[model samples]
Target: MSLLSMTKTNLKALFHGPYTSQFPLKAREPFANTRGHIDCDLSTCIFCTLCDKKCPTGAISVTRSVKATDTTPEKKGTWSIEPLKCIQCGYCVETCNKNSLIMKGECSEPATENVR
Candidate 1:
């Protein structure tokens, strides 16, 4: 009886094809609320450190560059994230007042380095 049941299960599995999709050939769709990764739009960013402060893992870094001139000073900023350290909690996206931060549905690509 046990041998018969095992044979039946093996035959069913053989005819069922693969249970999982081919990952590289056909990527699976991300879920609606998936916390994939954080993306930043530098054009609209105001150099605010809210995202950096809000990051629970301290993965975000915001640097402000100020160039002093005779008349006035020009302010520029750079935003960088350490993908390995990021927890993808979406806190940085919510804390951004300038709407520069976006939560991308696609997962971050495999990286050889920690900084991105």
Candidate 2:
């Protein structure tokens, strides 16, 4: 081996840069239109309940006549998501008519259970 090359390799190994995150302790900034989870905007939602029908995991529920504000017409609905149950199949994202649901594309680690 060349004398100069051996010195370069050893120097590079000593200066390892910052790599991974300190996640699960600190929250990261949300990326542009990041799909953390699909939530419903009750004000604009038309009570179509289309998302409820399309969700494969039954994560979303749509309820009409929920009174959030008197000024708004009570065109209410709900979106509930259980991350553990989600298959990440992208069905709900495709079916949303009002762009209420979207895919952020940042994949989350699958949660694991501890057996006693």
Candidate 3:
């Protein structure tokens, strides 16, 4: 390609604007049905392990921790998820026996100090 054509293409594309929203200044919203992050309500979970089993990435770890009680020591649900490993699949949320898990459409931008 010629130098002129290459320069024009690059300059035009930059001036055309980005496909994403303005950072920090704008509060961007995800699509109405966009699935982003997977979070679960710890209180509603029954330690069924259904969600853990259904997770394809094995990102969800359901640990049974002892609840604080004077009378007896009972197992309570402790759900943990690794954000880096999650594939954003809704299978865990769908297979949950309790309607505890929720898919939050959180932004995927990394924390950067670059002002430009």
lDDT of 2 by residue, 1-116 (tens): 56586887677767865455668776577777555555555556676678778878786676665565634534344455666666657787787787766666465555555434
**In candidate 1, what are the lDDT values of residues 1-116, reduced to their tens digit?**
36576888789999999989998999999998888888998878877788888889999999876653322223476789999899898988888998999998889998777556
TM-score of each: 0.76, 0.53, 0.65
lDDT of 3 by residue, 1-116 (tens): 56576887789889999868787779777886788888788667777788888899898888665554422213464677877778887888889878888887884455354557
Compared with the true structure, all predictions reach lDDT values of 0.84, 0.64, 0.76
Candidate 2 regions with alpha-carbon error over 4 angstroms: 1-11, 22-34, 65-79, 87-89, 102-116
lDDT score of residue 8 within candidate 1: 80
Error of 2 at 3 (Å): 16
Top candidate when judged by lDDT against the true structure: 1
Better of 1 and 2 by TM-score: 1
Candidate that beats the other on lDDT, 1 or 2, i.e. the better one: 1
Poorly placed runs, candidate 3 (over 4 Å): 1-20, 65-75, 108-116
